[model samples]
Target chain A: MKNILIASTSTIHGSSYLEYILDDLATFFKDTEEILFIPYARPGGIFYDDYTKTAQKAFSKINVRVKGIHTFENPIEAIRNAKGIFTGGGNTFILINMLYKNNLVEVLREVVNNGTHYLGTSAGSNICGLTIRTTNDMPIIYPPSFDALKLVPFNINPHYLDPDINSKHMGETRETRIKEFHNFNTQPVIGLREGSWLHVKNDSILLKGKLSARVFEVEKAPYEVESGTELNGLK
Target chain B: MKNILIASTSTIHGSSYLEYILDDLATFFKDTEEILFIPYARPGGIFYDDYTKTAQKAFSKINVRVKGIHTFENPIEAIRNAKGIFTGGGNTFILINMLYKNNLVEVLREVVNNGTHYLGTSAGSNICGLTIRTTNDMPIIYPPSFDALKLVPFNINPHYLDPDINSKHMGETRETRIKEFHNFNTQPVIGLREGSWLHVKNDSILLKGKLSARVFEVEKAPYEVESGTELNGLK
Candidate 1:
């Protein structure tokens, strides 16, 4: 049985999302000993250490051996020996670049297909798409290249928001920029609002987060979708 | 007769594209008195001095007057005094960035609509699109930004070429990356191959330059198009 909890955040331990997934993790670890924690998105960022520490503390509370994969010089080996993989969020472009550079995208696909549980956060949730078009980053930075791990069918625009308080220093709104993307592309883009996430297992996607997410398709007005709704084209 | 020529090379007097447009320039300017050159793309580069030297040497042979617009910081004045505008190729991202930063996109649009004869090459050709999605540069390096002058109804990916050599050192193939773009967008993306140019006059797009250009649409296979075909989405 393949089980994957691709989350926007794992800390909902006391909330509905964390409650549901933590219960599942508790049950899964009843037999297994360790779960591999891959923190590839942060790369050299110092702040990501907090995300790693948080995951370590959370998993340790349940007697789960959570190992951080960043220390491994050979990431392929770390991925190979993993029973489960949890990707944290920071910069999806940076993460995807590293993954493509190391040729580990296929390896990751194999790991997911082999029934290894997969978990992801913001940027982590982004790599689960056909392309990183939905990303908030300006498109000029080519990274090493542009082949994202096509874990899902549509593009993921993480940290999605409606209108928020603007300080003027932030420049243009992301919504306007995303509309430009809609103007340029022919496929549907999923604007995954902060705290919202997609969970995939056995070809099923379950939405988890605070509220419904927005979907932007060309030639149509944007619409809101509920959690657990099967998105078009993903199947 | 709007003689709009889109050249593969910005300085056609010296460089060689598949189809030479320098000779055509002389024929086109026989009746015209002045030509306006937009060197915004090659900001801080030597286009103002270098390209003018090239054009001066060549145009003087035919007794034509050519001046680069680097002298006019105000685009309105530049557009008003010129018989035609010649847009040159450079770092397109940089060029569009400057245009957007200076709020000249609308100004240029108005100039073109006013029937000032217009010509463009490479980066200049790219700005004639609704978006700059097809560009190869990493979108974040913002010499100014990724925002573009939306003259055409679609995006332009210039310097477009097939991954002919399959070298590992380079990034993903342009086709694959654009397909990845299709996953998130519904708008048709025009991939103008190297040496290919689009000549637009009075709402008509006439393909010029080499043998053919490849265009990719969402959900459709890539197609080869020859000169004179109308671009689908351009208004």
Candidate 2:
């Protein structure tokens, strides 16, 4: 059975780093005293060690220890031995690239599927989808492939935003981008807005938090899925 | 001499298709009666023929005819003999993918460099830069490479928008995305707002339109470049 907490964002506006979701994280990662952190996402181009320290500081509040995957002699071995795994968010391109480069994609997926506790935020949550095609981040780096872990049956558009009706910006909205994704893909996409997340346990997935998630399927109108809605059928 | 009109978008907020830039295009492509349109970047998954028809309808108002590159027996020959070239906006990933698939990247760059009258809007304009790394579109498809025409010295962010001061969205802002690009790339980037364009002639490139464009360079503060300012120095 897979136990995962995938969040749209680690922090909300006017909140400290990982503050809003820390309580939930504590509950999801209860039995684990330490988490193996993958800091390759490197938000704002932050150094990996610095990013790890940041995560450590946040986890310390809940009396948990954080260790970076880079600190291990073998990342593959680290994933195999980790009590829990957490991937922070930044640039999805770089994160997925590193996952392939380090040859951890297979092992990471294996451990997560073998019932290891897993947590992903933003770019981290994105890789849990069928593909990274739905990501909103810039292509700052090119990965060998757009394929992800497929931990979830569908793709996730993290930090998804609704169109501003009053704005004059002509760029495609979140909904428009996903519709375009349907042009070349058949997988369903979940527009996971900030403050919302998906709780995946075994074969079941549930939308949690205060907001409703926007669900998009091929040739069908996008509709809202209320909080606590079971998403396994979407898979 | 290179003659190019690179626009941020084909249409403005309330205008008809290409209405805002049609007059400038008419003056820039003064001697040309027909344009070879590259419909590879099919906006909203529109078919090539349908997208070309849209362009034809818009160009007809200016007494010009539009021919899609796909209509030709050989797209390479079509580009080589084109009197004027226009590449419209769409998903940049798919556009670049088709450019590579058709082996048009090198030939297209050569013709445009050899003094062909050229016009690009949004995704089209983005390719005029060093790479498509700065594009805002979803990665609906993967290209063989992120390398582009290098027609200009830097990269371009089409339909560039400023950070919303009042919005609560947690996604990275336009400025932040560009800054992230600088982490892996040294090239400067021009954030071209809607209605703004770059008029490239020979060795000089001038910012043109009603609004100012934002210029971002590595290790320096981003600043606004007024319309009509010569951007050759930026190169």
Candidate 3:
């Protein structure tokens, strides 16, 4: 059975890192003593060690120890022996590139599928999708491929925002970009708002948190699904 | 000598398509009777014919005929013999992918370098940079590479937006994304606000329009450049 928490973001507005979801994380990782943190995303171009320390401080409040995968001699072994897994957010392209370069994609996916508690935030959650096509991040680096861990049947657009009605900027809105993605792809995309998350347990994936998620399908108009709605039958 | 007008957008907020830049275009494309339009970057998922027609309609106002590259059986030949060229905005990834797939990258670069009047909006303008790594569009398709025409020494972030001081969105700001790009690459980037453009005349590239553009350089704080400012010495 697959067990995962794919969150739209690690920190919500006006909150500390991972603070908003700490309670839920504490419950989800109750029996696990430590988490193998993948700080490959390196948010804000921060050093890997500093990024790992940030994750450690957050997990410490929940009485859980966090160990960065980079600290281990073998990342593959770290994933294999991890009681729980957590991947923090940053540039998605770099994260996926590093995952491929380190040959950790398959092992990470396998461990998570085998029922290890997995937590993904932002770029981390993006990899749970079929592809990273819908990411809002710049392609600072080209990954081996846009293919990501197929933890879920569909792709995800993290930190999805609604088009500002009063804004004058002419850049494509998040919704428009997803529509363009559907032009070349058929995979469904979940526009996950900052406060929302998908709780995946076995075959059931339920939308959690305070807000609704926008669901996009090919050749169809996008619609919103309220919190607590199950996404198992979405595709 | 290179004669090109790389615009941030085809249309500004509350203006008809190409209306704002039509006069400048008329002056730049003076003496040119027909323009070969590369509608590969179909904005908003519009068909090539429709997008071409839109360009045709806009250019008609300046008494210039527009022909989509798609209409020609020989795209490379058409580019080579073109009197002028225009590439509208859409998904940068797909546009660049098609350019490579059709083997037009080299020819287009060559023609533009040879002084065939060229106009680019949004995605089109992005390709004038060293790479399309700074584009804000979704990666709907993977290009052969992010390498672009290198018409200019630096990259461009079209439709550049300032960070909203009051907004609570957790996504990386435009400046932050550009900063991230600088972390891996040394190319300087110009954040061209809507209605702003870079007028490339031979070796001189000047910022044109009513708004100031932001300049981001590696290891240095980004600064603003006023309209009519010469970018010839930027690199």
Write down the lDDT of every candidate, Cα atoms only: 0.63, 0.92, 0.93
RMSD of every prediction: 18.6, 1.5, 1.4
Clashing pairs in 3: none
Arrange candidates by DockQ, highest first: which order? 3, 2, 1
- lDDT by residue for model 2 (A34-88), tens: 9999988874334888999889999999988999998888999999999999999
DockQ of 1: 0.04
lDDT of 1: 0.63
Instruction: For each candidate, give its TM-score against the true structure.
Output: 0.50, 0.97, 0.98
| Tens digit per residue, CA lDDT, model 3, B84-162 | 9999999999999999999999999999999999999999999999999999999889888999999999999999999
User: Which candidate ranks first by DockQ, i.e. highest?
Assistant: 3
Ranking of models by TM-score: 3, 2, 1
- When 1 and 2 are scored with TM-score, the better candidate is 2
Of candidates 2 and 1, the better by lDDT? 2
Q: Name the candidate, 1 or 3, with the larger lDDT value.
A: 3
Q: For candidate 1, write residues B1-235 as lDDT tens digits.
A: 3445554445332344322565666666677777877776553556467866665665566676768777677767887768877777655656776677667777777767676677777767767666565555423223344445555666676655566463422223567767756654566767766556777666677777655777887789988888668764533
Best by TM-score: 3
